[model samples]
Target: MAELTTLARPYAKAVFDAAKDQDAIDLWDQALAFAAQVAANEQVKVILAKPGLAEQRKAQLLADCFEEQLPEALSNFLSILAENNRLALLPAISELFSLYRADLERTVKMQVSTAFEMTAEQQQKLIDALSRKLERKVELESSVDQSLIGGVVIRTGDLVIDASVRGKLAKMANAVGS
Candidate 1:
């Protein structure tokens, strides 16, 4: 079997290209979300994997589920995946599509985990700081992790800034132990 990323890349690229051509990135985004939802449903997964089910029937099921809401291109893409028995790759395809969109938009998604919830002012401050550091627009997703004790941990793609109290304390403990 191919790796999930390998399986998803071509699908993502195809959707991205189609969306770019149509000037309907949002439409592709919606389709990817819907596809991911369908792929995640256990019943749908079972039906997709059923040995006796024909490809045409699977395509019909997908069409019936999404034909009204999805664009023709997206519907056709879904049907192609059904025909190819690759419906399970939808989640990864969605993720890859998001990455492609973010790249095109010059936006970065950052995850900021703090010991406590931050005020809007603080969140904006962090965003500003990240924008300066990364030199790009930052879209932050914030969460509270009480285990941090205090301070924030920022994760942007391959970079992670661990400024949490727990991390500092661990470093100090290691220094003392040494």
Candidate 2:
């Protein structure tokens, strides 16, 4: 996963830069997302993996899959990826592009896991507090995980706050074992 991300980073950065310059970040975001979905299809993967297929054909096939006409720059980008046999990196590239977009827009996506589901008010309070602390808009995605036992765990980018009963138990166990 990390290797895929590393390989995709340069492409994502270049795409993000181009989108920023053209004031088409949202458009590029949608395009990349759609491209990634298309690239992830089993049939598409089989076709893309064919050794005899020409790079331009592969690129054109991808572009044609889009319902909307792609911008010239995006078509060129697809050509470059096809030329380099990097179409498989589209998902990672799309994810990285989203991260870049979030940074540019001063927003952060956070994942919250709890043993029980969070109420609307609880989610709002958490988002409000995180926004105040991080000084950025907070987008919360929450899920209930019974294994958490109690409390909640929040994750955003590289940061994680584990406040669950299971987490505390594991910490104590590790400390005693150590």
Candidate 3:
């Protein structure tokens, strides 16, 4: 995974820079995501991995999967990846591109897990607080996890806030043991 990400970083950066210059960051983001999904299909994987296939043919296969014609820049990007035998790296490229886009847009995506479903008011309040604290736009994905027992656990990238009842008990247990 690490190696694939390392290999994909340059491609992702190049695509992101192009998108930025074209004022089409969001459009490229979506296009890359769609291309990644197509590349991940099992049949597509087999086709892409065929040693005898021409790079242009492989790229055309991907382009044909789209309902609409791809922008010329993205089509060329796909051709480069196919020529380099790097179609397998599309998922990593898409993920890296999203990270770059998020950084540029000053947005953070967080996952919040709670013992119970959150009310809209509660979710909004949390988003408001996190936005003020992180000083960035917050995008929240909420889920119910009964194992939490109560409260919530919020995660965004490398940061985690564990306020759940289960987490507090574990901390207390560690403190007493120490």
Count the clashes in each prediction: 0, 0, 0
> Can you write out model 1's per-residue Cα lDDT over 1-178, one digit (the tens) per residue?
2599898899899989989999999778877887788777899889988889897687668667775765667768878888788888888898889899988998999999999999999999989998998788999999999999999999976789999999999999999999
Error of 3 at 172 (Å): 3.4
Model 2 per-residue lDDT tens digits across residues 1-178: 9999999999999999999999999999999999999999999989988999997899999999988888899999999998898988999999999999999999999999999988999999999999999999999999999999999999987999999999999999999999
TM-score of 1: 0.89
TM-score per prediction, in order, is: 0.89, 0.94, 0.93
RMSD for each model, in Å, please? 2.2, 1.3, 1.4
Q: Is candidate 1 or candidate 3 better by lDDT?
A: 3
Mark the 10 consecutive residues where model 1 has the least summed lDDT: 62-71
Estimate, for each residue in 87-160, the C-alpha lDDT of model 3 and write its tens digit: 88999999999999999999999999999999999999999999999899999999999999999999987899
TM-score of 3: 0.93
The TM-score obtained by model 2 is 0.94
